[model samples]
Target: MENSLNTLHTIAFTHRNLPVSEIGNLHIDPNDQKERLTAFQSAMNLEELMFLSTCNRVEFLFVTEDIVDHRFLHEFFNALYPKLSETQRKLFADSAEDYTGIHAVEHLFSVASSVESMVVGEREIITQVRNAFEDCRKMQLTGDTIRLVMRHTIETAKKVYTETNIARRPVSVVSLAYHKLRDLNVPLDSRILIIGAGVTNTNMSRFLRKHGFEQFHVFNRTFEKAEKLANDLNGTAHKLSDLNTFDQGFDVIITCTGAEKHIITKEIYQQLLQGETDRKIVIDIAIPQDLSPEIIAENNVTHISVEVLQEISNANLKERSKEIQHVEQIIKEALYEFDHNHKSRMVELAMRSVPEKVKEIRSNAVENVFHNELASMDSESREVVEKIMGYMEKKYMSMPMLMAKEILLKKR
Candidate 1:
């Protein structure tokens, strides 16, 4: 059987190497992953695979014996993303950062621990990694090796967060947006219009609500989702279609959605303003911002965007960098533990057939070799002999595995 651990590799296109805009090009919708990733994995000859996509990063973690060089990456993107133009494909292949074996393990640990995030110490990446692994595992794209790695990765992340101060003074985009709005001295009762009740907006709205901001009107593509967030904020819900007719003036707009284009066009913004010239706060945390650029330039709108938040995050990272050394030390220990555990699991698998073989040997002794002797034994004596042999059989099944594990663990 293949030792998938030794062949582990990761091809990552993240904010580190590419701009956030370019990283967005690599996103695969969850609805399309089952078919797309399955075929991609088979085409790439990966034994096991997991795909993780976040706002700022997209990574392919897989196990295969083939070396991951420029040629391998060219073929990788060609097989997985054939729709891309030749130049786009070559750009991705050239830009990808690849890691193999132990380096791959360390990278995953860093990712789950949030040390590798664009905003260092943001805790959301751990949940993203976990959900991504579970999704790929459900699609049958991952097997034992990836499973083991993720398990250790999560454990290591938990330890890093628990033992270190990396996550202190939370500085996520949501919090940054809240701080910006507060600095504007916007009244708590100011009308808040929220567009798209996705995770980012949900968190942002909830943070505002917690800070005593009560007036909220949530509009989403799905009325039900809109209602859900509206109820949480004790506000009103409107379908996204109602945005044009939403005549109620707003003091602040918190918008983040998965739309490819601007959800708030120039016309929509004009109608939303209701002829009021007073300045408004608009927080567009979406990757491809929900608010149109024209609206920001032409109107009395103070816009807080993902790009602005990234600038703040970059500064926050310097404060968080003090904890990176401690986090990396934990990750180093986790890598060693994973290695030992992996070898022990391999030994356990290698010894799995021992029990059946021992059983077969005992059967041969009692049923074949000792058949005539057992036929002559009295009933009481036969029972005693059977008990002794059964006891011996149990020992024979367990002893070798125990001894082997002990020896292997000691060597580690």
Candidate 2:
């Protein structure tokens, strides 16, 4: 039987210092898809492989029988990011081998369960993982081990949500934005400006409206999308070209655009600062950052990056510590069941070989019976003998099949 206990290798890289809020600034070119696929093909002898690229992080997940060496990972990363310099190469080394065996399994579970997420229990990550799995399926790169593990991970996450309060409080980017605003003593009615019309932006807009932020403005590269979101939220839609125009009017500015470079540069900050009094809170949720860190350091400007939001997320994690113990227990139990069931399937495959052996024996017995009856038996007698042989063969194989079924049922 093939070994079902395949090792999982996962590598994740996110913004260095930004909080979870600023993760939206991270960017990857669509052209990198081929490079990533090729890299995965080269990196490991994987039974299954998946790559998840998001604004904040790039992660690769692999299921393989044997451990992979760093050379493959090195070449893979190099191929994926041909633009990476020597310094960046060192910074993004594959850390998978370091967490082999149990640690690796736990790490994967943690990620799938959202324990390692920037925002703990954020539901979007599970969807992202599923999408990655689907991509692997499209590439014909997945097998039973990967499929089972991913399915288990997803199921465990759902169980955690149902069995805990993790999702009840809503610890997503939108919720975190609202929390930050409240923490800064910003009034609920404060004029807020949200840039971008993507998932994160839409969520932020919805949260703002729910929390009674009456005055709002939205801007996106796509005017139609921005207008649609604004209309849904009953806010004004500003053209991306007019972004600089309202810089000073908003008390809270949240930008989560897909722009590769800084959208709100020093010039824009300077303009916002001229009329702004006190601290104007700006949250750059984009990976490359919509606002420059240098400008953020200026007086009267309070800038929060994705890394900072990660810290805030960490604090929020404390609130759910009670639930962690429960979720961990559930995950462990599920993992054990999954492993056991996988082993049982292997055993069933092994037992299936018994049926072929039984058939071979039955064929020999039937031949011997024919040899003895050839002189005395008629055609009807020969037909009856064949029927009896078939019945006897089924009876002989039944015990082995039943035993295999029993083992499978026991594991389940």
lDDT of each: 0.88, 0.70
Give one digit per residue, the lDDT tens place, for model 1 in 33-107: 899999998898999999998777899999998988888988887888887788888788888988887789899
TM-score of each: 0.88, 0.75
lDDT of 2: 0.70
Query: Highest lDDT among the candidates is held by which one?
Result: 1
Q: Write the per-residue lDDT of candidate 2 for residues 317-341, one digit (tens) a residue.
A: 7876657788788878887776666
Give the distance in Å from residue 215's predicted Cα in candidate 2 to where it truly belongs: 4.0
Error of 2 at 103 (Å): 5.0
Off by over 4 Å in 2: 1-4, 13-35, 42-45, 53-57, 94-105, 119-124, 135-141, 165-170, 185-191, 221-228, 236-251, 258-260, 267-279, 298-300, 347-379, 382-412
Q: What is the lDDT of residue 211 in candidate 2?
A: 74
